[model samples]
Target: MSTSRFLPALRVMLALQTVALLLQAITAGLLLSTPGGRGLHNASAGVVLVTALLYLVVAILVWRPGGGSPRAVAPAVAMVVLVLAQAMLGALHMKALHVPLGVLMFGGSLVQLVQVLLARRAVAA
Candidate 1:
């Protein structure tokens, strides 16, 4: 497969992850504030869920044995694990861990973005 096709998909995944992370961060802040509400929690959870799915799709595409090498397999597995952990944290109302998880999620997305960009550049050259 051409790098251009997969790279853009990867970037879309990263962008989704980034937005999810930001939403989590903001939701964490709101959760810590006065008069707690379920709305914010639900919203954040939804965002995380959607972004996790997006990441999963990207991971699958990248690691697909038929289309590419097994390079992204590890990261894809890690991302799935992270998504589950993050969801668990949310369900358990572990607000303290939200920021940290958001940071980790963002870092993971950044790594994916960098990898995609690098691969695309190499293919272009």
Candidate 2:
């Protein structure tokens, strides 16, 4: 199993996740700070959900044999779980929880992205 085989793809996905995080962050701010862009804000939140799912798929890809770190599964699962809760928070109009949770999600994704980018791939044994 070559750990480096899928590294590039994993990195790309993580980067995309970061971009999605940025978009989500901006939308969240707009949602809270202004009243004129609810549509775009909602759309961005949906995009964040979709991107999180995409990130999970890539995370699983990296965690599989012949690829990235097994520990990546943690963040992958966390993203799914967190996103689900985030959706629920939004639906319930729990802005207090929803906003903070979104921040947490963004931070988690950022941390995972950094870890992926900085990792030294294991040499195939």
Candidate 3:
């Protein structure tokens, strides 16, 4: 399969994950300040996890030998695992780890998105 064929789908995955990450951040702020924000925060956590998983799936598809993608597979998988851990930390009320890990995940996802975009540019050029 052509690598370019997967580009659009990969881009969509990146877009969804970006939005989910933003929502997750907003919900985190809400959770800290609003009494009723817990529900929204939890719901947004689920969104982040779900989108990360979906994004990973796409990454794996692109990583398949046939996909010809330059993106690394390990980081995508790690992000999924980290998100799961983040959820567990939140559920167990491990703020010490949860808060820091959330920040890490935010940075990681943005980095991954940039990598994908850079790969696309490199391929096009």
Which candidate ranks first by TM-score, i.e. highest? 3
| Residue-by-residue lDDT tens digits, candidate 3, 38-68 | 9999999888888888887777777674465
Model 1: clashing residue pairs? none
lDDT, candidates in the order shown: 0.70, 0.75, 0.79
State every prediction's TM-score relative to the real structure: 0.75, 0.82, 0.88
Between 2 and 3, whose lDDT is larger?
A: 3
**TM-score of the candidate numbered 1?**
0.75
RMSD of each: 2.8, 3.1, 2.2
Candidate 1 runs further than 4 Å off? 1-4, 34-38, 95-98
Predicted structure with the largest lDDT when compared to the true one:
3
Residue-level lDDT for 69 in candidate 3: 56
Full-model lDDT, candidate 2 = 0.75
Q: What are the per-residue Cα lDDT tens digits for candidate 1 across 50-70?
A: 777776677667656337656
Clashing pairs in 2: none
